[model samples]
Each structure stands twice: as structure tokens, then as C-alpha cells.
Target: MNFFKIKTSWSNAEFILIKLCMASAYILVGSYFHDFFAEYYSILIGIFIITAIWFVYQWLKKMKTHSDLPY
Candidate 1:
């Protein structure tokens, strides 16, 4: 049984903004509350970089597929 429904009309800008806000909030809160970053800094950085690259790749691919530029 499906417990929740998702809306897929979100734009790329909203996705990026939310991701940035959440990551910054997590880092800020974690630093203030404990040593979360001190222990997993590398892992977090790697994931952030990889995800950014993946997002750019997907965005570009989608744009190219839907381009309407005139020759």
C-alpha cells in the first residue's frame, strides 16, 4: 500500500535550493551540537561533490533532449 504521494512538478532551481539549505543547516547544526563533521568530513564532502556533478549532468541532459533552438 502506498503511504504517501509525491508531486513531481518541482523545478530544478527549487531542488538545488532545498538541497543547499538542508546541507548547510545540517552542517551548522551538527557543528554546534557535536563532532559530526570532524568525523565524517571526507564522506560528506565526497557525497556533496558527487551529487552536484550528478545534478548538473542530469539537468544538461534534460535540456539537450528538450532543446528547441533554431539552426
Candidate 2:
């Protein structure tokens, strides 16, 4: 029952890049359609921030675990 035991094959850079692309797409679409996105802009931004923070946290945790391993 380990919460942080999940593993990913993608490198940190790739994961971050994908998340950035998604966030950028949302912003771009919102900018293009102000009427539709104005109300949800804050929510979208919040999601992006949360996801970025999660990714960083996971990466840091992974790094810490790896650093502690005997080579």
C-alpha cells in the first residue's frame, strides 16, 4: 500500500514538456475564444499549476530515492 510507488518510463524533461504543451494549448485556445474561456480561465490555470507542482514533486521524490540506492 505504497502511495508513491507508481513508476513512469518517461524522462522528467519529457513529462514536463508534455504538461507544458497541454497548458499552453489551453491558454492559446482560451485566448482565441474569449467568450468561452473567460469564465474557465482561472480553473484552467489552476489545473496547470497543480499538475506542474505534482510533476516536480514526483520528480524530486524519484531523484531522492535513486540517490539513496547503493550503486
Which predicted model would earn the best lDDT? 2
lDDT of 2 by residue, 1-71 (tens): 88799876887877898899999998898678999777887999999999999999999999999999999
C-alpha lDDT (0 to 100) for residue 49 of candidate 2: 100
Query: Highest TM-score, which number?
Result: 1
Full-model lDDT, candidate 2:
0.92
Candidates' TM-scores? 0.52, 0.51
lDDT tens readout by residue for model 1, 5-68: 7546888887998899999998889879676458777888999999999999999998997796
lDDT accuracy of residue 20 in candidate 1:
96
Which residues of candidate 1, in runs, are more than 4 Å off? 1-28, 68-71
